[model samples]
Target: MEIFLALLGFFSLGLIVWLLLKDYATPALAFISVSISVACILLILEQLGFGVGAA
Candidate 1:
């Protein structure tokens, strides 16, 4: 499950880069996308027992 989330996060990061490079996303949109992706990655990490907050 951790590996899956890592892969998903990697893919999402790549997609965000691609969108920016391809001129498909505005700066605001890209920022929003990245923020959401980071949030999801953090959530997944939490679920996998590697979160920042106290248990």
Candidate 2:
């Protein structure tokens, strides 16, 4: 699930960057969107306790 979320975040970030460069739109929207995605990914990791070992 962590891998999935990471991939999704990466894809979203890439899309935002592409749009910003191709459409010449303000990067503010892209930055905000990417930030939200990153936050979500972090939240998911925390909820899953990914850092804790599965003894």
Candidate 3:
């Protein structure tokens, strides 16, 4: 699980890098979108009992 999260984080950051490489509408939007995506991903994982508080 830890490794999975690490990889997911790397992939998320890489997505930002890719967006930065192109002419995205704005950096702010890209960051906001990715942040939201990460948040949702974490929440989903948590619901599946893979989060910090999971037993």
Candidate 4:
């Protein structure tokens, strides 16, 4: 699971870079997209009994 998240985070960084390079999104928009996508994934994982807790 940790490995999966690590890879996801890695690709997510790449995704932001790609977006910025293409001028497809402002920095703020790219941040929002990545953050929201990660949040949604976490929610889905929790629903599937793969809970991750925040302290």
- Against the unseen true structure, what C-alpha lDDT does each candidate score? 0.68, 0.61, 0.64, 0.63
List the candidate numbers ranked by TM-score, top first: 1, 4, 3, 2
Task: List candidate 1 stretches off by more than 4 Å.
Answer: 1-22
Number of clashes found in candidate 2? 0
- Candidate 3 lDDT score at position 3: 58
For candidate 3, report its TM-score.
Answer: 0.52
Residue range 1-55, candidate 2, lDDT tens digits: 7666675677577666756664565678667666665665665555567633321
Q: What TM value does model 4 have? A: 0.54
User: How many clashes show up per model?
Assistant: 0, 0, 0, 0
Question: What's the residue-level lDDT of 41 in candidate 2?
Answer: 63
Off by over 4 Å in 3: 1-22, 53-55
From the highest lDDT down, the ranking of the candidates is 1, 3, 4, 2
Per-residue alpha-carbon lDDT of model 3 for 1-55, expressed as tens digits?
A: 6756665676577567657754755777766667665665675577567877532
